[model samples]
Target chain A: MAHRALRIIAAALVGGVLSACTTEPATTGTTGKGSSDGKLVLGFAQVGAESGWRTANTKSVREAAEKAGITLKFSDAQQKQENQIKAIRTFIQQKVDVIAFSPVVESGWDTVLKEAKNAGIPVILTDRAVDSQDTSLYRTFLGSDFVKEGQEAGKWLVKEYEGTSEPVNVVELQGTTGSAPANDRKAGFADVIKGDPKFKVVASQTGDFTRAKGKEVMQAFLKSHEDIDVLYAHNDDMALGAIQAIEEAGKKPGVDIKVISVDGIKDAFVAMQEKKINVVVECNPLLGGQLMELAKKVVAGESVPRRVEVKEGVFTQDEAAAALPGRQY
Target chain B: MTPPDDTGVGGRPARAPGARQLTEHRLFWPAAVLAALLLGNVALTHDFLAVRVQNGHLYGSLIDILQFGAPLILVSLGMTLVIATRGIDLSVGSTVAIAGALACEHIATAKDPGSLPTVMSAIALAVGVAAAIGLLNGFLVARLGVQPIVATLVLMVAGRGVAQLITDGQIISVSSSAYKMIGGGYWLTLPFAVLLAAALVAVTSLVTRRTALGMLIESVGGNPVASRLVGIRAAGLLVMVYVVSAVCAAVAGLMISSNVSSADGNNAGLWIELDAILAVVIGGTALTGGRFSLGGTVLGALIIQTLSTTIYTLGVPPETTLVFKALVVIVVCLVQSPAFRARLSRRRRATAPDRAPAAGDVGARQQEVHP
Candidate 1:
């Protein structure tokens, strides 16, 4: 283990120094001199390849940066906070005009963002946000309203079963434990469900936003709850897992236990079209073009908004089926 | 000045039954874990005893526990063998993703709707992809002598990248009936995936125990120098173990994708290596190498799955479950430690001298120390 850590540290240092020595201005900002010749150097620390949405988001940002003539230095954090911290430090040392990242989780980022800020490198949050109360740490956050998405899912549930007298035994398949999405979605959905005493979350567990884990947790839910009327998954993968469990029990998923989830990935749309899933609240992952545009604006000394909300919406079976062919995220 | 053979038996010979005690020594803690998990679950829920079958499948928390545990068990079995050699494969999770992607690719690209041969070919392609990764891991570790963690980690990062590249960041929905059977099929009211796990366990035990392979592995783990001197072919064994582990992860990936009927490159098998490692550790395999227990690993997987199931069943806050599991694992490790047991017995005798150091006093000492 000691040897392995040394290798990792050595590799990281080499990667850092290599990135630092490249003297040419690889990118240009949108405002000052974003011409092809005058590019603004920007570094992006990604949160590893955690999901399909993440991969798409990373590609979008990279492409957007290229299109905007910004020199983009990319680092894959592999889902570790320490690696991300190191990447940010390297970006700062490189004296890039701008730095941005999709944090793996919400906490443990204040210190690094503060460092970047002190170094005069403005940071932009792409997909996920940090928990710091100081809004001045980063320029702006560009992402979905996760809590609103959850509320939308909840509202849809309330409306769907408004006239029914039967009590709805719902089980929630949450994302990673203590993550922003997990906490926000749980809070948002529970806030709405609190008013209806007839609806109860019979069982809830974290699937960690992975298909295998989601399936495992759903299996556990199937065992404990005999009459789960609805499964509210934090993502479509978990919803898909619950669908398997529902089918394995010789029950129809759409008919026996309704599934409402977030993350309108193409597969989720397909599932919706097939009647395996009932609803999904879309969290647009194609935020790259928007993030790059904002990064350029920040570096150009332009006033960007404190928070730029991505255009996101909810999808029902009908809508999902209709949009399956064109769904990008 | 001469080295005594650790593999030497007590009296008759080095291969005698008494030496079996060496491997058997690690079984107690896993059993205790199983007992604790069962008691905890039964205590938490009144209907834990109820069992039912629905839709030609078993419908109980136990089945749910097993269903969840199957993949963990399969992967941990391989992890146990790998860790038994003082090696870790952080790339197993990504290897799983790659396998799933490969399977998805084969199924998605295949034009045959219901052809059995094409489905078989896809399965072969998936398994072959997993084996190739295993071979690569083996090559890096056994040939290049890179640290198992590092070698696997390179793949861990790059493997998922490759999977994403193959899928083009798309979750390929597999419509093949043959591929679906791997995850969604059943046998005698049990999930076929669960059965597959059992089959792997049975086969692993047979191969490891029925031949000299188990002894060779233990020898390599306990004393690589000595094993090499005795012509044990340590490198070949190391490579073989990692390859086997990779194949197991691939099987898990196949099952996972088949269950969902889609291949997600990003989230196919995320952080599962951690669970597999934890299961191996909880099963009494020393991370430092030279010891392993397959049955104990199976018990460990069950304990983990059951604990998670119990947490959800009892409506415990999801965030606290990890803390609880960490505590339980720590306690189990402490209890299994010989040093802890020695200190405990010494304290027990110091506390009360009259009972000839009660054989069953371990639990009492554990509660006293923890509480």
Candidate 2:
């Protein structure tokens, strides 16, 4: 009886492996654009639906691809580097016209990019860049300048409170520790605000770029510090959380604390409209149309700039009211 | 085993009956340690213990600790029972995500998101789904005889994916006042979350102590084969504990999402299971399973929350905050260990022989054999 059971298990395993192998080639065959239609096939590997910004970015990319009449093979990496690398390899095996991806992290893309390069396929980065040390690995990088976004936030704060001698106690709700956005945003904000003695950061802590943690950390901050003038959050989610915390503490958010944050998600706009948040520095996630254009140009052997910067706008309460109607996320 | 009556061991006298009793009380060290930490916070931060009434609600560091610690207390309470059954549910964190996601998604998509009925239905949906996930874990561990860690791990990894699917990878924000009250609002000048946690704790205690359920669970965990031979129905009890744990996690999820008025699938309850496990361990519940303490777990959760708040109050650098937390946790765990305490006392006795023999001296010498 045991021998028969073992035999059955072995047979089932073999059958499953065979079926998996058979299904793969079928998908590649149908999706492959190596036909007389003369349409450009693009393989886009997305870093999974991690946040509202990412979801908007993915939607934009998908819609733009459809509008541009480009055959897009989309793969969701589920926020794993290995999954992203595997998706890229699958794209290479399928021999798409062009490859593009928003890398999950800054490192570990040298080998895969080299593979795509050797295959004579141009690669474009959207939203996030990689640190491969070899510029030839990809055609160009396209994303908002996170540091510049931070500087703009600082500049806005400076302009708002210009000539005020009273010290402005700023408490920062940073993003996930060690992330590129968190590091660059902190550096940029500090760089712009360092010379001004009136602007002092009383407390800074990582909220891990989440609403719950942001609320919890802000609660702690409120309990610890008696006077907090400004709340500088790395992202809108954290700012929203801090708004809740401030409300729970029985204080006005925008009027009392003058909250400032990054990322232009729709919720941030709603908060700004309600006067709960003071300002939002936009880190635009709608790179799909731009990416589509760049991919087409790269696939056609046209030389593009090494780095492409997407234009973004900072929103005050007034701007938020005007933009809330058209907000996508 | 009766060596204490016959002679003293390791140049120490036999423990006094009162001293032995005190030392054997499992909660003694945990309570003392928690008290010490709270006192330390009071000394370090001015107005740390001050409570003020604001908008007919209590606002202070002490109140904040209980309010914020409510989720950890709930999670750890469930963890204590699971640990008592010789099982670990690493998926509580994921269950938290799924529960919050389901509730927030329901409320966000509802026709009248602010309605009490909508909020009630959303909570029910979240709890029901979480219970089903717990049933799966129990089925895998008890029925299929899978390793507890491995079985729960399946959900630990996949549950976040399920949550993301429910929320469609967006942070669903809702404006339901009833739901918000569950997490962020107050009642009678106290946080609703704390009240809910206290009520749950009381119910859990009454059910476990007033019935044979606790004993049966302990029997099963102590020896599964023996429990089966005695017809203790270990499988059913295991399923019940897991379901209870899932429900607890769901309630915690509700509180968390409600506090922020948003449900983030990716970061709602990240690493909360680890914190719950630490709370369980700090509460004097052995991983090997058998005896447990609900009161100790409450104190453990409070200690952790207080430590976090103290980190900010002390102005620790953001980079070294985690390191500082680790150092304090290590110190607390070391101080709680009977063996470690015994060693310290022994070294002190060796250095100064003139010191009077205290209650711990006899207890410390006896602990050498166990160590």
* Top lDDT model: 2
The deviation in Å at residue A12 for candidate 1 is 12
TM-score of 2: 0.93
Error of 1 at B254 (Å): 2.0
Fraction of native Cα contacts kept in each candidate? 0.55, 0.55
Angstrom error at residue B127, model 1:
2.8
Instruction: State the lDDT of candidate 2 residue by residue for B1-371, as single tens digits.
Output: 11121221112343355655555566777777778877888888768889999889998888988988999999999998998899999999999999999999999989999889999999999999999988988887777666788778777777887888899988988898889999888998899999999999999988987898877877777778888898888889998899999999999999999888889898888999999999989987778776677887888888898888887777787788889989989998998776787888888888988888764466566676543
DockQ of each: 0.37, 0.47
Q: What residue runs in model 2 are displaced by over 4 Å at the alpha carbon?
A: A1-31, B1-24, B357-361, B369-371
- Where does candidate 2 chain B have its weakest 10-residue lDDT segment? B1-10
lDDT of 2 at B364: 68
Q: Model 2's DockQ?
A: 0.47
lDDT, residue A31, model 2: 48
* DockQ-based class of model 2: acceptable
User: After best superposition, candidate 2 residue A232: deviation in angstroms?
Assistant: 0.3
User: What is the per-residue lDDT of model 1 for residues B269-347, given as tens digits with 9 covering 90 to 100?
Assistant: 7888998998888876778777577887888888777777777777778778878878877887777665676677678
lDDT of candidate 1 over A1-329, digit per residue (tens): 77677556656744554454233223333443323446677788888765678777877777887787777878888677777888888878777788888887788888888899888889998878888988899999998988998899999999999988788999999998877888889889999988989999988888877666677677767766779899899988788777876776677888888989998888788789998899889898788778878987897899999889887888888886668878766
